[model samples]
Target: MNYTLTPLGDRAIVIELGNEITIATHNLVQSVVAFLDQHPFDWITEYIPAFTTVTIFYNPLLVLPKTNQTTSASPYEHVVNELIPYLDNLEENHSELGRTIEIPVCYGGELGPDLPYVAEYHNLSEEQIVDLHSKGDYLVYMIGFAPGFPYIGGMPEDLATPRKDNPRLKIPAGSVGIAGNQTGVYPIETPGGWQLIGRTPLPLFDPELEPPTLLKTGDVIRFKPITKQEFDSYKEDKA
Candidate 1:
């Protein structure tokens, strides 16, 4: 319950769980989210949790505004005052493991244009590069950049590489790329600089669905290498 609450304009309050990014901090954030999701404040509209922070979006008018206080309070202050008691008495357990998700990927060739470049840069064979990447047990730290695009961590340090010097005008949706210490799948066709390593045939984002994004914060991903024929087969099956 030791956390700092900060105002974000008129409708949002960001809960700073800790100063550093760690599993313990993320665990606390998720615990709070689980509690509030079931017993949410009537004014609250959104709950967005990241590596070590949680942002609460609420309606200003819906919360009780105090008139007797010496200083006027914004919606942020109103929420802080109302939610402080629950924050103090909660029990947060950090030992629980995240849910594991298996993702199928087709590396090299047309699916991964920069696969050779990454292998050459690392002084490793294409097979070695793929092995290093797929072997790591990656965690979904947060979902950012494009919608449903998860900013994942725990990539093998040897596979670390800087973003492209000149970013491509458009990267195909489902393109998997490594940027520094993290790796992510491009959920939609957009400009990007991450070194493209492979492509997942999985449909990551579909707005019509109840939950559009295939992944969420705290989910663990294990990449299963797939052949081009299998990737094409997946697409055909989905179609």
Candidate 2:
């Protein structure tokens, strides 16, 4: 992985991780995070990590000496130059981190209004569709589009369905869906077009909970097909 540190001001530097975010790439992100946690860099105020980049916020007033204020040199520039060498030496080490989560999904019927349509479109039985969707391993890319919404990859190529012709006005939270070559869980109820397969009782996002997101980037996921009764049971238990 390559990194580019850009100074936002005297107080912060945004580091861009020039690599695709994957389970294999998490080590680099973790390393940078670890460094920030231990290092007493008074200039740094915040750190935000995305798919393949981390932005660092800092304060110039804290890092610069009061006496050095006489010079026209920017403290940010000085810090960037000093950090460049260290960043250049950093290796691309991936974290051995990833968790597989089994999610129960009730397909067809009211839960999956479009399941029959999808099955017919692919000239396959609905059961086959369910099996195909549930059999594969999915990698969490990033949580976006809504809170706890996990953008996952690694769906079977055959299951690469497109968005609906007419998007629904409301898609329930915990709705498992597929769009194009990807699939995801809706963290909150909102309008969406991905083919709804089932609804899980698990809360994907809860503001009151610490680390509210159920799935994080770099985690692995698997779907387990369940009957409507099973889904109902799970929901009741959760409630």
Candidate 3:
């Protein structure tokens, strides 16, 4: 329940829950988001949840008219006052548990052209790299950079590698890669600098689906290694 309120532009307020990107902070962020979702203000437009903050955007016109000090105080002040009570009362245990999703990946070869580079960088064999990556626990910290792209955390420090100096113009969807101490899958084809080590056949983003993105923040991710033949079969099954 510890936080600081800061103004964002003219009509938004940011509630910073913690200073670090730990699971405890993540839970607090989720708790705040859940509280707002269940008890939304009429003037509030939307709320964006990040690693350690929840940004609430509002309509100043609606907010200004509702405040008791309409003539004396700004909309930002009024909104912050209204939000404090609710945030203070939010229970940390109210944060929902996330789902665990298994993703099958085909490592090396054409799909993961940078696998050798990562192996060499870590001074390990390509097979050892795959084993380390596949066995590590991962969490979806946030979705950003591109639509449906998941910024994951909890990658083993042993597999850590820097991003490519020169980014690729168009990485195919489902390409899994490591950057720093994190790992993620490209939900859509886009320019990226992460060192590609594998790829999944899953269609991670689809406009036709109810939720376009396959992953959401707080979800637990498991990577399963698949053979080239198995990867082909997965695609064929989907086709």
Candidate 4:
């Protein structure tokens, strides 16, 4: 599907791809990301890719006017026009699949406070809940809400569950949860409403890390179930 570009405030431009959230739209978004990064304008500051759109941030003052054309009224329009040619000629990105990162989660009990509730909601056993979550291969569609938080896709329909009626005041970092047709984890101590299934031991956000955020758009994530004993062991090892 073709995309339309619109000015987002004064410093950003939002490209609207197809409204549907499918693999095709996501790939197209990534292709846009790849092209922008490869052929970057001097004023371009950053590119934020969501499920089906990429919002580009830039500096208006630094944006060099097109050499061959007359000055335009809106810098955003000029930027959009310059971008159109690159997108129009973009080929489908045939890059290899992203590396699958396995996250070990301690399922049930306190770590997964909503596990029993979720199982009952679907007439499923807690073991079945664990199996369904661990077996699914999730794709990182975007990182939003909280820092390092990943909005993932690819959960099987049968295991889909709704969010908590009342969200907790604070969900701890690494709390794995499902809401409606989507599933994700809380990267930091943040308020959220997704059904809690487990908790990962990793600190998804770290101030000392080179790129602070652990996951990125287009990454693949898979959960691995671990016993409480294993969870403690892993934590101690990291410590």
Candidate 5:
């Protein structure tokens, strides 16, 4: 995917990281970061990644205009030209950024009222559904919408289901769910529309923890089905 750098005034260029936020694109983001750091452009500040793009924040007041640079040569143009060559030649790197966390979840019961419905909709037994979800390796694409909310990829196509027509008032935290092509865990109890197949008792977002987010971008997540008894025990320990 190609990048388009837009000048946000004299200070910063927003690098648009197009629609490739998979493991393949992880290297692209890191390469950009490494290059930017080495170049030492005072104007560039932060590089934020979303599902499809990376927004580069910059500080213009600090970076003076080049002595020989003309008004026609914008910082965005200069940065993009310098960056593309590096990105083009660099191989896509897939570094192990985070651990594969196996989260234990309990399916069905009050915690997952829609579990049966989802299975029925897909014409599969509840056990089959659980096995499919548990077996897949999910990649954490981006963290957004809520704190520690991971937008996971790698869900089985057969298990793909639409979200609830109407969102619930209070979705308990540690909810494991799917919406369209993506699957994720709700870090905190809040309103949501994702199809709830199970609930993990793990605290996904712990403010008291050194890193509040239980997972981050580039981490791999897999759900392990456990009995309600196990779920209860884990929740109690967290408390």
Candidate 6:
């Protein structure tokens, strides 16, 4: 339940739960988000959860007249005071377990142009790279950058690689890539710097769907390698 409250702009307060990007910090962030979702303040606008921080944005107009010291106390101070009590007992509120999702990926060739680069970078064969990547137990740390894009963690250190010096202009949706110690799938075609290693046939983003994002924060992800033929068949089935 250890945290610090800092003001963001005029109407938002950032609650920093921890300093690291470990599972412990992720849990704390989730706990705080869950608490706010269940017991939302009327003056609050929205809350954004990150690796180790949960930013709470508020409506100052709604909070102005409600503060005890309306003449002196700012909305930020009032909101901080109100939030401290709830956060002090936050450790008691545990978030529910995340859902495990299996994603089938087709590695190398046209879909994954950078697979060879990654293999060379690690001084391993392409098959070895695929084996290590597919066997990893990943977690969706957050949904960000682009709509439905999942910033996944838990990539093995052996597969670690730096991003491209010159980013690609338009990476296709479902293109899986590695950047630093993390791995992720591009939910939509966009410019990126991550080294592409594979691609999934799954449609990760659909604006018309109830929940547009295929993955959510705290979800578990398992990469399953698929053959080129199998990847084509999967896409055809979905189409």
Off by over 4 Å in 3: 66-70, 94-96
lDDT of 1 by residue, 153-208 (tens): 78888998889999999999999998887788988999989899899999889998
- lDDT digits (tens) for residues 1-239 of candidate 3: 88999999998899998998988898888788778878888999998788888889999888876435447877887898888888888888845558988999999999999999999998999999999999966887777788778877888899989999999999999999988887889988889898999999998899999888888888889999999999999999999
Query: Who is ahead in lDDT, 2 or 3?
Result: 3
Please give each candidate's TM-score.
0.94, 0.82, 0.93, 0.93, 0.81, 0.93
**Candidate 4's residue-wise lDDT over 1-239, tens digit each?**
38899888999999888898878888888888878878888889998999989999998876756573456456777787788888777876635556688999999999999999999999999999899989978999888987888888888898788788898989888899889988888888888788998999988989899899889888999999999899999899999
Clashes of each: 0, 5, 0, 0, 2, 0
Candidate achieving the largest TM-score: 1
Q: Candidate 4: where is the Cα deviation over 4 Å?
A: 66-72
User: lDDT by residue for model 6 over 26-103, one digit each (tens)?
Assistant: 888888878898998899999888888989999987776643544687777778878888889778355555999999
Of models 3 and 5, which has the larger TM-score?
3
**Candidate 1 ranges beyond 4 A from true positions:** 65-74
| lDDT for residue 21 in candidate 6, whole number 0-100 | 87
Ranking by lDDT: 6, 3, 1, 4, 2, 5
> Which residue pairs clash in candidate 6?
none
RMSD of 4: 2.0
RMSD values, in order shown: 2.1, 3.0, 1.8, 2.0, 3.5, 1.9
Candidate 6 lDDT score at position 63: 76
**Can you write out model 2's per-residue Cα lDDT over 1-239, one digit (the tens) per residue?**
47777766556677877567565555676566656667746677777656666667767676666667766767777667656776677666646557888888888889888888888888999999999999988877666778878877788988778899999999988888888888888889899788887777778888988888788766788889889889888888878
Candidate 2: where is the Cα deviation over 4 Å? 6-14, 19-45, 57-86
The TM-score that candidate 5 achieves is 0.81
Worst 10 residues of 6 by lDDT: 62-71
The model with the greater TM-score, 1 or 2, is: 1
